[model samples]
Target: MSAFTMAASAVGVKVTTTAKRASAKRATAKASSSAFSARKASLNGVSLAAFAAPSVAASKSSQIRALRSAVFAAAKADRSKADDPDAGKGQRVMIIGGDGYCGWATALHLSNRGYEVCIVDNLCRRGMDDSLGFNSLTPIRGIHERVRKWKEVSGKDIELFIGDVCDYEFLSATFKKFEPTAAVHFGEQRSAPYSMMDRTKAVFTQTNNVMGNINLMYAIKEFAPDCHLIKLGTMGEYGTPNIDIEEGYLTVEHNGRTDTLPYPKQGNSFYHLSKCHDSTNMIFCTKAWQMRTTDLNQGVVYGVATEETMMDPALINRLDYDAVFGTALNRFCIQAAVGHPMTVYGKGGQTRGFLDIRDTVRCIQIACDNPADKGEMRIYNQFTEQFSVNELAALITEAGKKIGLDPQVINVPNPRTEMEEHYYNAKNSKLQDLGLEPHLMSDALMDSLLKIIIEYKDRVDKSLILPGVNWTESASVGQQLEKAEKVKA
Candidate 1:
């Protein structure tokens, strides 16, 4: 007997030899005719009571028909539940750029909270790290492996779609398939220094960021019109306006007129300018198409581990400490780990809002829970506290000493053209009013970061710590242009 036949026989399935095949085929034909009638009846919504009635003969075929009808009804009910917006399953959220830092953590956070989460990413952030010849200080797993590990640890599944949001075909197809109730957009070039590297990079940053956002707006309008769009904007979009920074809009009192308008934007870098463009496009889409959107103008997110990321080694998120992608606090913590001087640019008086990564994920959840009204564009300043560069370096120094490390702080020439000191208060009451409890930066948190960095000190590259890209230089022209061309190609 063939192996297949032997296996079938072991499982109580009749395995006929050539001699008995003809008889088996005849019997199967009769059974198939009966099975087809049962399936047809089930699909037509025939009453199961008829099958269960004592007046009807309870043959083997009758039992099969009843079972089929019951299974079909149950499956139909499940589909209805999944499709209903009022159903709990309607909490489906599609996270664009869900493989990156904030994206990855938010994906897991929502998944842990019983939201049906799906991640859409092109893995361009990982490609950028490859181009820069550096990796996250803490090793990160591949996107496929990361999601797999999350499933293993949490017993929850987060769907993954590998595609760029700029590709409308792919993005629209995924949107249709997922049918998300809320879409969280983190799919854009996020680094200011990287955007300022050269002409090609600057152009690429704006094109990628702006085009992807436009595509997303249309995709939501076309496929999932009711889908709430939660876009991750930057605090840098406002720059250092002399006046107090409101959440997203500022009221103006002009000559004999008063109206609310979008806050004046003074974006500092090409990347921040791209964000400004995205905000404008999002606002336009909301008004033009009656689409709901929540633009989160978030601050500098610090720390690596969230409750979900720490569950498994493969689930760990990326930690960037290079000048190109690292934030001030992260760089200081890593610099102290490798016994390198914490390089504070100029007088280090440039202040900006900051938040913990844990809070970052929580804020996203709050936005998802409380969606904006139709035709409304809501903006929330997403940060817990404000800290200057000097304050961050000092905190790192204090934390380092407690762990028996002598962390030295030094001032370096400022690479960017900006004020060293300025007024920096920004309102962040919207999320707090919506029940978002913030996590303040503390010595304990800093100490935990130091300990983690010490464990991964072997992976730190001291050479990439300091600022390299100068904002004063013009766009690349000669050999730099050629290199940029190759990268573009």
Candidate 2:
């Protein structure tokens, strides 16, 4: 063939090859897989998998740039307007830990603000309830039932998924599916007492909390790079420090060099240590990958119900009172319900920050709508006030007395190695500026919690309410079992 004819043939082959390759890429992006998520994620980006910034260059054709721009724009908008402290609707949000107390409460708060919401959880709380004999300190419904009730009450439909976060396939699949603008992850083992229950519990806490976070970051990278991640951290990770607590970030003027470390997590127990590990791993990955993350350094949450949860019994979440999964507040509520005195661990002067359940949800939603930029890991201290064990007992006692029932305050020997008395000066201006109005632990909220428990009063088992799980120390599993046998003998 002539030179021109040969050149023309080569050009034709190149065009055909490139076009075929593009077609295959589109096909790959369009493929969808089954998700183990019981509350299946919506099909927003389920067909398209996530890619990184470096790879994005190669993928950034005019067509791909448009998609990227759109995704980034949506993410940016959600973060910028999430908290308008001026009293208005919040940003659209999806909560990964929406199955838990804070998670459910946060979901409801956002929904009230008219923000779109989707929740995904593996029903770990349900499993815990099943393993133990008693149910949530209050009547609880399954995931589907709860979602349905929310719909009935508010005419809003919250997309939900019941699946494990550690499952990368499932995590990625759900991320692609939801195309969520922002995500609040609360899915982790969160009890120091339980983590210290035994070695198995310790191992489970370590693996589950850390791995779940790792998997979540990976899923965000794989399925939604531009999506914002808001995570719940703990003040216990910082321990009872002599220094004042700065919400999530700290500034240092060093020797001609300055760097803000993650407030140096001096974790107290396995569970708190696991959260520290989670934050550490997250900071590393988020910085390396330029993923935006917000870590909420939250304190102990109290109070019974949110505005929505209080509106109906069916709308309430699993009100756990068991030692394995319950928080101090919920446990206290259950104690009041069963006519048992609140058990205050020894040296009840341990003061920590506290927030009502409604505030916990509000703080989480605020984080969601405020995405940190690339190379930024935003941190916020999520609490309104501080209270000691004795202080909380006094409040509970006063409220219980008003109801014509005396709620005793028993001094139980401390189980964990926490400071019974120490300094707890924490600043939480970020969330407040983000328009989070604080809800105090009011007598009304306590009454509501007590009333909810009263509905399920017959279901409360007074025997298994308290299990002395020592987290500050350890005894072998065999030794523990032998001791139990000896007790029986």
Candidate 3:
């Protein structure tokens, strides 16, 4: 203070020690004000000079406080924008394999929520029905017809692209043309029994699921690096572990060391193995290329109708009750409706996760609304509830009795090799935490399924309802040789 006073005296301004100290404080405040002005300009696009310039007569403390408040407000606004899923309205979403069960409903749901939706499918799921000599228990229209009907009913258009995801050229072209904000991939061979049928089918399943996913990753990298990849993985990838299943990873402490690693995978079939491969590749893409991905390890999806799928008869979704494609609950309800015994495999103790088709579409929307961060590979176990085969049969039996129908339960040899009885608990809190309200299984849902089945009862192929593909049997020698020759060629 004495030095400040001496300097002031030399400058021809007489000042007391207190006056000198006060003068120095004013200069420091002025400097801080200038710095804050610059920071405020940079923090948000607004310049304090244009709107809330500090008055010359204002106290230094008040000025500083005002500037700090403005900066904090701006930063908070930015975070709110980033986290709001509503910010994604009117953005584009490309649904690969949108003609299929989960994809179809999700496409409509997103479109209804104000998204521009387009579907990319090769009509292979329909082709599979032809090749198998069976059709869905409920008749479904062609993709073109379905989309047209959707437009008529909802007054919203969904663009259709007819091509296979395995074809890179087609996939790349679709990506370039659409330039999607997100891509929901349901383009995979999804049947475990079908994949286990023979060598040819197994090879095709691996090639289609694994190669198609790889192609999608590369296409997204090239065309839309920022696009979120929402892939439909399977709970079958985890199989039936003795311990409770974690979402996608596990933290381990081994030999006095600890690290978090991917949960150990024990896929039960070739189809499930293909899903495991997809998960590995997805993790690599995120780490190497800073790509964003969300792998939904989904449970067995039940029910046939979502809000969108029920809008019109032409917009009806497929109800598969065949052993190859149908789920346990769906098959049970159909069996109950048709006066056939509910087939429970191996003591009816095999348990797995389950969810409604309505929940399936909603989960997809939730994933899209809350995308993963860049270089982040998010994993969610997408299911609402868990039930054993025996439990499903029992529930259906009760529902069937209330509707004046006789339902019987019969235990058959398990076709697939798995734990007949074991501990089954999986964490499904992530989806619910992200605002997913699930539709739990109930008698009303079962009754609705029975009514639909009764309407289309004649379409049910009783012959296809029984298990055919046995996991214990190996592929024929001719089939293996043929596959080998094809590989050589």
**Pairs with backbone N, CA or C atoms under 3 Å apart (clashes), candidate 3:** none
lDDT of 1 by residue, 117-142 (tens): 89999999999999888789999999
What TM value does model 1 have? Answer: 0.80
Pick out the ten consecutive residues of candidate 2 with the lowest summed lDDT.
31-40
State the weakest 10-residue window (summed lDDT) of model 1.
Answer: 81-90
lDDT of 2 at 378: 85
Alpha carbon RMSD to native, model 2: 16.3
Model 3: how far is 270 from its true place, Å?
0.2
TM-score of candidate 2 to 2 decimals = 0.78
Q: State which candidate, 2 or 3, has the greater TM-score.
A: 3
Tell me the tens digit of each residue's lDDT in model 3 across 1-489: 343243223333323333342234334334534554566566444434434555565665755677667656654553344233233343578999999889998888777655668999998999998988978887789899999988777666789999999999999999877778789999898999889888888899999999999999999888878788999998989988888899999999999999998998999999999999999999999999998799999999988888778888888888888888888788888888888998998888888999999889878876776677779999999999999999999888888898899999888988889889989999998876544667899899988888888899988889988877788774965976787799999
Model 3 lowest lDDT segment of ten: 7-16
